[model samples]
Target: MIKREWAGETAVIIAGGPSLTVEDAVYCQGRARAVVVNDGYRIAPFADLLYAGDAAWWDGHQGAPSFAGQKWTQSKVAALRWSLRHIQSQHAYGISDSPERIHSGQNSGFQALNLTYLLGARRILLLGFDMQPTGGSRHWFGNHPPELHRDSNYAAWRGWFDIAAKQLVCRGVEVVNCSRETALTVFPRSTIQACL
Candidate 1:
């Protein structure tokens, strides 16, 4: 449904990492098209799009907080096991021949990035893509409990983003990492203020 929604326009993707601050949320609200990641809705209530890859996450939220933007869940075989009720792109299966599916990143942020590209965002700015915890919170929402995700799978996650970044850049899209604290170095780092 995101056919050229922001063609040649800028889009800000808000991830749930701790680096995602209230200031960043404010900047995206009425400025640019906001594409929020799972649980990021708590911050950017008016997000233009919401993306969740893991089915368990949908179940855990129990769909408590409804979103106004189109909610997308990965259509991969494993992701459908949880449920597709009330979500878009459920029946879509297999992988696309597009570059977004090249490495088929597993994390929600990377997946959201690919979707944004498909949606026609020429310049995409990232916020809260810390890729690691800051202080005590793994996420701005405090949802990623340590007990559940012990390992954090840093290497695998980074690798996926690395591949995805290269593919997107080669395709002529500018992916800027606005979260300066992020461990991910694949994308050129920039400040949220600068991108805004």
Candidate 2:
């Protein structure tokens, strides 16, 4: 579970997409709960929460930030815990994954989105969720590392994203895509200035 819930507050999910800006991060720092996903920490080093789901990332991120928020991941072992695991088999083959402690297999950013809702943020602003290649790189950090293996057709991935967005909205979480140019259009678009 998150150390504390932000029940009536807003959350900013910082994805590693190139559209993310340092100015946005700085502006949202104290104004909203910042949930940084995976290597998003490289940009928003002062994030309120850090979530890295892939086991490989955990093994390699030896010097991640020591933020006040606890690190979150999907655990293989089933137990009563705060951070939940995303059952991959359930999400494969076009199955609809729920936010009830399990996540959709879209990507780490999706997992962080689930975590933000689970932590009780009534409003969420998605940052850097470009969901496309930028300058030959999959993320703002640069090209996809040779070691990582993530392959999904654009249509299938979009379906998964749509499902997750629907669930979040149904549960009373108002989600907005703050990226000026993002492939994800499931949620209504908003500007960082307007949100601030």
Best-fitting candidate, scored by lDDT: 1
Q: Which stretches of candidate 2 lie over 4 Å from their true place?
A: 1-4, 63-68, 76-100, 152-154
- Quality of model 1 by C-alpha lDDT: 0.72
RMSD of each: 4.4, 4.1
Count the clashes in each prediction.
0, 1
Model 1, 170: alpha-carbon shift in Å?
1.7
Candidate 1: residue 43 Cα off by (Å): 0.4
After TM-score superposition, the amount by which residue 148's alpha carbon in candidate 1 deviates from its true location, in angstroms, is 6.2
Report the CA-based lDDT of candidate 2 relative to the real structure: 0.69
Error of 2 at 97 (Å): 10
lDDT of 2 by residue, 1-196 (tens): 2322778789899888777778876778678888898887777777877876666665566535344565667644321233333333234422233344546556777777766776778899989888876555567676545565466355655667787777777778799999756888899998877986
lDDT of 2 at 22: 81
Candidate 1 vs. true structure, TM-score: 0.81
